[model samples]
Target: MTALTAEGLVLRGWEPGDAAALVEIYRDPAMLRWTRFPVTTAAEAEVWVANQQEGWAANTRHSFAVLDDERLVGCVALKRGIEVGYWTAAHARGRDVASRAVRALTAWAIGNGVTTLELRHQVDNEASCRVAEKSGFRLRETLPATPPWPLPGHLHLRTG
Candidate 1:
């Protein structure tokens, strides 16, 4: 994987050493509250990152670590069918870190053969919606909770 630089943040492949810091980001209540998946332990985060690496190794998913200066701050990823997920440090939100990261990642994804990207946010998550809007995704529609995604959310799509 290649490291991406945009708007003062570094986006790169996951590193084993980034797990602890990733755990810290995931443990923040505000950050966790909106996430589709719940994460409660550092070890879990480590395992998650390890799994992310394995996915990267096999070319099934593309996960990138987001860094500010030298600190691991968050992540942005592309799953099957151009589905995307991203989270920024509680301290990093509202600073355009996500917008920049998304823009860079989207450019990379399209260049790599993804024709469209999809994202979702819970009904009440205006912050997340803002990120998607800022990143150029259009609101698709509200849908019933898909079998595995416990919560109901608004789906958005961006095609380029």
Candidate 2:
């Protein structure tokens, strides 16, 4: 769970030193729109990084800092029940970073005994749908809007 590479991207655990980079990428409102966790300032980003480390220690989450040749570009996280989520830096969008990172995570999870993985994104987020398809997560259902999840979304699943 140290570092995993897919295509030309590196998926590595989030480190405290990465707070600056986290703030940089998360400045994208598109990235903030999907999650309740918002990393704005350096202090906020530091807390976010700390939470990621805590998640790893608790074995409840697997959050990776995506890098392209050592430059931080995004984040991909897999929750305990196998739910997958991601966001690419504004500058890195349209480069298939999300799909490649998800695929790499799926491979690792399946190899480690995970049978299925889930991906969810708002219906209007067409880009996420493309990433889901590219990552081999098939559309399974459209979930009703619920608390914390503001809008109706598609749930895609990938089974080992």
**Estimated TM-score for each candidate:** 0.90, 0.96
Model 1 lDDT per residue over 18-108, tens place: 8777767877898777666666677777788888898888888888999889887778888874888888888787688888888889988
Q: What are the runs in model 2 whose C-alpha is more than 4 Å off?
A: none
* Candidate 1 wrongly placed segments (more than 4 Å): 147-151
True-structure RMSD for candidate 1: 1.7
Candidate 1 residue-wise lDDT at 17: 84
Candidate 1 local accuracy as lDDT? 0.83
Candidate 1 backbone collisions, by pair:
none
Residue 9 shift from truth in candidate 1, angstroms: 1.1
Q: Which ten residues in a row have the lowest lDDT in candidate 2?
A: 26-35
